[model samples]
Target: MTEEIQSKKNQHPADGQQRVVIVGGGLAGLSAATALLGRGVSVDLIESRRQCGGRAASFEDSEDGSLVDACQHVAMGCCTNFLDLCEQTGLGRFLRRDRTLWFIGPDGSRSACTPATWVPAPLHLVPLLFGMNHFSFLEKAALAWGMVRLAVRQKMSDGDTELTAAQWLHSRQPERVIQLFWQPVIESALGESIDLVGISAVRKVVVDGFLAHPKAADLLVPTEPLGEIFGEKLVAWLRGQGVAVHSGRAVTGIQYDESGKATGVVCGQDLVVADAVVLAVPWRAAKRLVPKLLPPVDESFVGSPITAVHLWFDQKIFDLPHAVLVGRVSQWIFQGEEENSVSSEKSCRAPAKEVEHHCQVVISASRGICDGDRNELLETVVNELQEIFPKARGARLMRSRIVTDPTAVLSVRPGIESVRPHATTPVENLFLAGDWTQTGWPSTMEGAVRSGRQAATQLLKMTDMKAECVVKDLHKNAFIRLLVGQ
Candidate 1:
């Protein structure tokens, strides 16, 4: 049976605890391992990469050697499960919640939209919707009504959901509203062009993200670089929990018995024996390790690209914490928190030089930008920022880099829901976990965490152990419940 793949000899549980081997150290795998804590389970997590965190990751600047995120990852207050994990793991202190979302209009108009916590559910969004100074009064009203319509819209059939969001929005929303309000917002949230994404996905963003509660739209941004937060801090927490974390260890295949039940995973030249396995890697990787357990990775599943342009200026140019630039190539701009340049180890002391102010421009769903020309893309982005912010015109560009993740997020495309697999696989001992899985949410941090917790719970349920890690969504007030008929 172990001829095709290497034999996975069992590493028997030392204390009669259930041995759970998670073959991935991303957020999903990390969360799954966290859930098994104190549940009479022994957990071991293995990540192929030298560091975990997967897409929510960062890289060292080639010139300055400072760490910068590939793309900014933000959490919403609606991401109950992700927030809970952060809080549970002591990573909550690293999160900085920005209540105001700054929107920059085409005419250089700036609007700071902040939802009201004191106000009732749907009404809380009234201030936010009306605060868009770029839109006319009628345009604002139209946008508000369109949101209500989408919120109340019931789930469509699989065939009907295959309609693209742009197709559905063109008929329901106004031209200007679709361009200024819906396009940028939806693209930023979904990480896919509205023309390519499915309608049902947009509905979820509107309902769970905006209408659920006053704080649902609250943005939880990490104060530190994601590399340190997840790759280092998160891994340290897992290690402290008595969970064996093996970074830089890649699992080549999974070993199953005659009944097709997984016994262990073959990592490198070693086999991590386990009573249960959580294949928490991406769909492509999952399919590679256990081909018999998964379907072909075809057009049914795809990824959306996200690009982040890192820029260092001689001085601080933009003052806002973050800005959402509409009607431009830039979707979101964040002020990097790094204040000091990377210190050289040979110097034995830090050298005094002009402190370069760093900022990043994030473009979600940025496919074929400037005809795939990096210089042109950079020039256009700089010009756009200069046009929107007067201060940017005088700032001297120091060093810059364009980072693009071609397959950053799972594309919630037409009819993709039917293809997303459940946590429990056909093999009784194997469970699946990743953002690409069906988590009733888009390809987001919340979805990834929920997927992991779901897989953990499924494993726990099978072992007849306590399995409660998934957190509830933000509370929907009675008014919202009645409006959306939730």
Candidate 2:
């Protein structure tokens, strides 16, 4: 586990002890605290909201006695950070099923693509040769060729170029291929259009999804609620380690020295002192907090909006755990699995055995769906699902809600790469940690966890260097090339 990895060296200040303060209680913030606390450092985590987990938060619907994951999120097979954290917290065992993505078209056409085995180099082009859904065999083959060519070309040029994903792909391959396959995936991954998204950022998703591991594309949705699997467990673990965590204490201001080093944070009416501080909030919140911390970078880090539609049905409308729906009211639907047990009147009981029971459903990357007009959106999904599943025509709507974050993720457009902050910032005792930062992966749960690990490692290194009078790069020259010239 990263906890022990960062704990080996208990580097402290001249006073022989140090305290670390982490802002935000999301995955990134909690992960940072876990890593820092493991290294024998006292830690304090403050969350501005009443609850933690940020976008990853969940709650029990008092109306149903069933858990509701706000937007119905899942992890992919390539999510190393999620896997590591799961293992660390012993939550890995709860991951129950591997689902093959079913891409359903508006006309009721269906295609199931299971996770492919990972292979390196030329042989990795097998799936494309066979083709899937809209793409022809020839088109798929060409697309595969284009990806390899681009990967090689990127290695050769190695210079950070400013170009949208649409421009880059169109320049290399046919426009139709990108419109059919690339556009849909890109919009879902980065939460924006290809015309505005960056080529490098989109390419990272493709490379990691298609080139990295065999099962990288497979969907891993936990059978239980997200909080049950990780969030609650993580909080318990942190508290067990003697780390102080305060919820609903939003940071109003950051106090810094003349050198621009962060000394502590100002929450509401309290000033909390610390040896080091990590700003692990979302991109939108982070932009508000440290706009001047990194020069020529602040403006680019601001993000685009992402919306999620949560709909509950009277029965199981879509039997599939999760599927990507193209040419529909929504891009994807992640159906929550049956809860292990339900509580009724303060007593635990098995869920009612009936087909006409409440079922959870989440629609991802939905657009043109009015938040106030629930009837309009509900009617639309009902009509759409009826076409796909004739039996769904009888499914009655119980309730529906829309969740949106105007800045869910940073715009992955061109030239934005340079704006992403590193684990260690110019401010000596302050660091940046979030999915938007450079975690190699795209804006994902894995990326967020990785950023947390990076931040913790960095804070520890700074302390070590100060104590020993020697500078050692925990990343150890890995970022030198990117820092100097490519």
Candidate 3:
């Protein structure tokens, strides 16, 4: 899918102006733009879509007039980059959630997990160990034991061990626990089956979610529409800062200088010159742009499909936030309160009437989920919901839309440890930034934000931007701690 030209307005740079061209207006690109703008550098952001926000986007249903997210996406309570963006852009208030994750199991069983306390940092691990969702009491104990072992070990040392997540779980966890809990969670996170996902990657997720905090694992789903939250705000902010954001502008090729530096970018018969370029698109997109500039990305990098089944019901059938359904056609279900509230309140308040507000039920982390067998999938989900929520049995189906993206995320396979691209590429002045890149975390919002921040920080070295508040604090804290201790 090549994008057509959306904008050609090129403003001439004033005297002593530093320019940066960012391709792909995803979280990474927008974050980079914000950071660069803060540093007094001019940026030009080109997005392939007419709208901003790459994957973290939202669409509206014309028939029902309800807002629908691209996927049932959320963040962790401990996402540093997301928090930083919120603070920087004054979008913190929108990052609202009840911090409750309800996991529904094979037999219509439901478990709710919430943050136990606010002790800050290290003490956050308590609630998870004692939490009731997803893991069994014994499995939680085993995970705790594994965390202790993982924490004590060295950092930046968990490399390619030719081990699978399933193998790691099998070795460290009981067979029953692996089948019942870890399999679903791992499959969702890594975008691959547990038997294929690398052990180290799984360990990283375990450390971040399980070991980080008692509430760190709490689901932080966005309340507002996704594009409204980050994407649109970013574009408006950039334009306010005199930055050019070109939606539907796609780069077809990159021209290199004699020294192997990025000189210009070609997009639909347009040759845009730039002092620096950031390829913030996905791996496959990057492959199309410049295959020789980076490492040989595995076809496995395209990964598997993640289908989100959005089913609208006449009456509200579920009240739980979201649930994990084991031993069924779906693994996760995200209740769409936003969509439900969009419809008439009278409809929402009514019981199992044929006339009611719309409700969206999301089936997430759907690996082999396809659109061919729509009836089969819907029947399975409806039956399951009937078992869990008795009112769902008679609720009329208003709309059932099945959305699937094959390139949802990079497959973190067992030997895929080497496929992730680094920040710097062979082409100087051209860098890469995406969750799929080596950001330590899984292909998550946190990882995406981290990658963006790192890329911005690196690019800042070429500019004369003042150190950020966080950087200044780091310096101050290091000096103060050294003086006090020494």
Candidate 4:
């Protein structure tokens, strides 16, 4: 549903000026708008929500009067395009990069995974793998063999896309290794199980994220709520660049000429005309809005769920900023308020005392628990935390909130990559941008930004506006080149 606001008369470009109307105010739409505006093009970005960021947004919680993110979104060093957009939006400084990943066993045994600094690409993780006490020596050897095979293998052929990651990995690695090492990473990254994810998608994650470079696997988390990062800061930056920002306005339908060129979009009763249009909405929304250009709804492109359990304690429970829980319903636990302590900000609406110790537990591909009782989920999460962190055993639970997103991201199912369309469609004037598009990446922020940049580049070319919008991927390090012979 679109949040209605006072209709500002639709602004049309003057003579010789190119105007573009971008539907959807998510990262894709925002990225396209920024790129087009940088090229001296007029942009009118339309969003249905009161704030920008779409699925990666945050809102003020009425229960505890705190601003909580809908779901935790993290980025890796391999995400060059998304990092570039963060730099452009002045959000680079608010990001915190942690190289070491902490893993907590069910019995509360802690293990840290940190790449070897002196070691080169691919081998940089060897030290950590051998040093990790959670897995047996034989398990480590098997896992190493699997990784070697993944790094040395060629790109997925048409036949390979038909196989699931689980099927391929199970054939190569043991079940213990699959459950301990591969399953968590695959589910967290693709928002689906290995049995459901395509082999190509899993290969991309491993090659680009882990084996590409030493720093490629580093995780970057936002210090503030997503609304502050993408909503307030991004909108402010866009306004400073002379682009028209229209929040709380939804584009009901696209306005096309008889010649089959998209002129603009219909926002409520207002007809905002433009020289070009970029439909950056989700797959379902895009199908409903412009079915002529996009194909019919395909169940194959359906999305998966992500659930977050936020808990506030009277005192600090965990010392680490974040930790991955092994053999638990909760996959990752993030210390929300301790890192930067921005909870006192006016936008958060949180009482100073209420946010003393805020923690968030994230469960990706959480279809099993999405419909479960909220109180039961909270209790289960608390029990898991107490088991993992001894400090949490006696901590008083001040407040708790559970946020479940049924369609957090498109499922990376086998054979789904072929169905994903490119930025440039058959229609000349209509462009598409979203994480679901064929960006050669999964449904992450990086993929969304890449799709937007690709859309902007194609739109510029179609309009005869010469400009480069797409950013190149990170170059492979020398070690990878020597090992893989790329």
Candidate 5:
């Protein structure tokens, strides 16, 4: 490893070149590297893991030797920064966009939520919500009233950050609306229960995702595994731009000068110096590495857990690519890649008889079953699937694999947002980039990318270089602009 570092040092640009060292090769680090490289700045990205993508990553299935994601990560049309990064990295073509949302109720009733093209911004989902069977007419009316209140409050900047989402909605919405509509969306978006998530985060989700534009709520799922999207394709593009990509290199500590300015990073025994450094790691990792540079993060601002149950069946069970299971243990279900096709660079080729239908059931904010028996959880998911899809009742389970991340996403509690740091830290020439940063967004891929862009832009500004590399948000419609006072 020392020899390899020395070789990279030999290939480093001349002393005058403006080089950056980015620690953590996740979406945030990759985004920073891409932005810097685009501006002819040299970058060295170091990742502790063998592969990148951080939370949005995949691993080999020991049973079938197929690649499976740690958890299913989806994107909404409002995620402009994430989509921009995908397009820049040549991954835009691999995304599968679905405008309609399929909702399956507990008793096997189905409803579809499709936006109306003829309708204007805030009303685009009105027809679909009215037509849905999941909620009663009274419940829909209550939900509409709550949405209007939220929009008005957001426009007026009158939200109470001290309140939880559940507390905010308790008096306005009925129990049915809370369970049938609010909880699922809250869990899916914030990865926390309504009572645990902040009202500000909920407002961001409802406003930016649903009311901002007609297409903002459209969901995009990757047809390929996440490793291929963020690992192979992204790393290749970065390398093509003369960025030094180093994997399995853990940055032990950050180096600073007597003036309290970042100089470089320390990887084990070797120190790789740079003009600037971006610490794009998780909050816990950042606290451990640079405790003095960052503000004290609250101990209560921990992470929420997510669990993915991957199962192979004897035959196809789900007709749709993905669906949300209403009031079920499994929040979302994704139809895995079909047989005879490669899902990733490392996916295994299977024989004809070995080919089977694959499906993944994801449970977000899954604290209830994180420590439960694996077999019991698998059986519960299977039973829930059988309840929803009649075809799944007779399908034999070929194999099962469960993936859990205890610290999947940062818990967006009511007061936790105040603790999230900004892109620019106290240390000069040092920046922070992560999903946990203050990006005016929650902990999503979009937030991660936005933080990266923000950090890179700040670094460039400090160095007196071009700083407008980050993409802007999607334009709001005329009516929405008027409503939100944009």
Candidate 6:
């Protein structure tokens, strides 16, 4: 397929213009191409998979032949780069913003925690914390204090301490608060257990994700399937803008001249040439291709697992759209809505599908869970839902699936910052972009976009064209600026 398409399109870089070859079709590679739009540089984006969105992709349902997300991906308002890329590509309209975050307590109580829209930066979270029905007044107070302490004082924790989030919380916060609040929140965000995630990551979740701006916590969910939003729409947009998107082609290795400068990539039987290269694949793939260009990835990084439980019932069981489950095997539950039919065939106006009883439960850091027993895990999740929603007890389950990504995210351990490489490599023309890189963010869609844009920026500079592609952080108000000394 790649060879047939390669013969038709002008795959080579046009003469005289600096050409960039992006090696992966994930958010990182896609963003790298988008960043170079109208920059006088030609881009050839090669994606091994047929679809573009890497991890953030969808699968075809076996029964109905429709789209189902491999996992539910959401964006917090703090994800500036991710949101910017989506909006700039006109994919933002497909996003559904949920102002209120629903939290299901241990005792099956529901609380709607919504940050005050008009309130000041730090104070905007006051209503959000106090609204949690699960916590007592004293527990809430302690939780608030702990958040401030983590955000202000301990955010600058010394790298030598090697403190985990669990250790820091347990020392300063009450045990109940640690279990009921910090455990689930931190795990869900970092995709690692609180005991395993570093305190620096937790600080990022609090400060940039929560305290940075009033709108920072707003949740943006895709109304359309991720496959269509990224794999189809975004890809079409990039192609229309003259970016060469070569999908279904696996790049074997990087091509370098004797000077150690990247001249192009080896895709299948073709040596696709370029003046510069953006290696935007995951760490494992990057290390495999250019082993000497990276640090000892075996020691520098580790992956965290995430599981998604897809359940279909005869009738709707969940009353809320989405909720954060406290102290349970199921970390978060999303009540599936009738998804708009943005078919892979490029039917932009097809009739929307009326989905029924279709919902997803996400479990992060699910190592040692049920001892790798799928049946037991499914039973526990179903029973937990039945306990919380009486409707679920009687609803007949039609079908179910358990999807787990063993290495879903980069585990942000203490002292990890030292090993996280920058986009600029010693090879001069070859740049790196991935969520695993040093983007000052977690391994998320946001981090991937930032890394790609940063790589593009550095590459443009190498071509003697100075440009700033990565956008600035969200605007912080005076109070936040003064408090954080930003």
TM-score of candidate 2 on Cα atoms, chains taken together:
0.82
List candidate 6 segments past 4 Å from native.
Answer: 1-12, 155-159, 340-355
**Best-fitting candidate, measured by lDDT?**
6
Model 2 alpha-carbon drift over 4 Å, by segment: 1-16, 96-99, 116-131, 154-161, 171-176, 257-260, 296-298, 340-374, 465-486
Task: State the RMSD for candidate 4.
Answer: 2.9
What 10-residue stretch in candidate 3 is worst by lDDT?
469-478
Pairs of residues clashing in candidate 1: none
RMSD of each candidate relative to the true structure? 3.3, 6.6, 5.1, 2.9, 2.5, 3.2
Residues 245-276 of candidate 2: C-alpha lDDT, one tens digit per residue:
77777888888878777777877655677679
The digit string of per-residue lDDT tens for model 1 on 101-129 reads: 99999898999999999988888998899
lDDT (CA) per prediction? 0.86, 0.66, 0.67, 0.82, 0.83, 0.87
Number of backbone-clashing residue pairs for each candidate, in the order shown: 0, 3, 3, 0, 0, 0
Model 6 lDDT at residue 322: 93
- Write one digit per residue (lDDT tens) for candidate 4, span 261-333: 8877887787888788999999999988877666545765788999989877877888997887867889999
What local lDDT does model 3 show for residue 48?
Answer: 82
Each model's TM-score, in the order given?
Answer: 0.95, 0.82, 0.85, 0.93, 0.94, 0.95
Candidate 1: give its CA RMSD in angstroms: 3.3
Model 1 residue 455 distance off true place after TM-score fit, in angstroms: 0.2
On residues 1-486, what C-alpha lDDT tens digit does candidate 5 reach at each position? 545566655244774678789999999999988888767577889999998888889887765566677778999999999998889878999898999988887677888889876878788879756756888899888887787688766432235447888888887789988887899889999998887887878988988988887888899998788988898888988888888889998999988889988778888888888789999999989989988766677564689898999887878888987898878898999988764123322354444444467789988889979899999999899999998888999888988789899888888987777788999988879999999988889899999999999999999998888677679777888777776556
Task: Give residue 170's lDDT in candidate 2 (0 to 100).
Answer: 75
- How many residue-pair clashes does candidate 5 contain? 0
Alpha-carbon deviation at 373 in model 5, angstroms? 2.2
Predicted candidate 6 versus true structure: per-residue lDDT over 369-401, tens digit per residue:
724889999999999999998999998887899
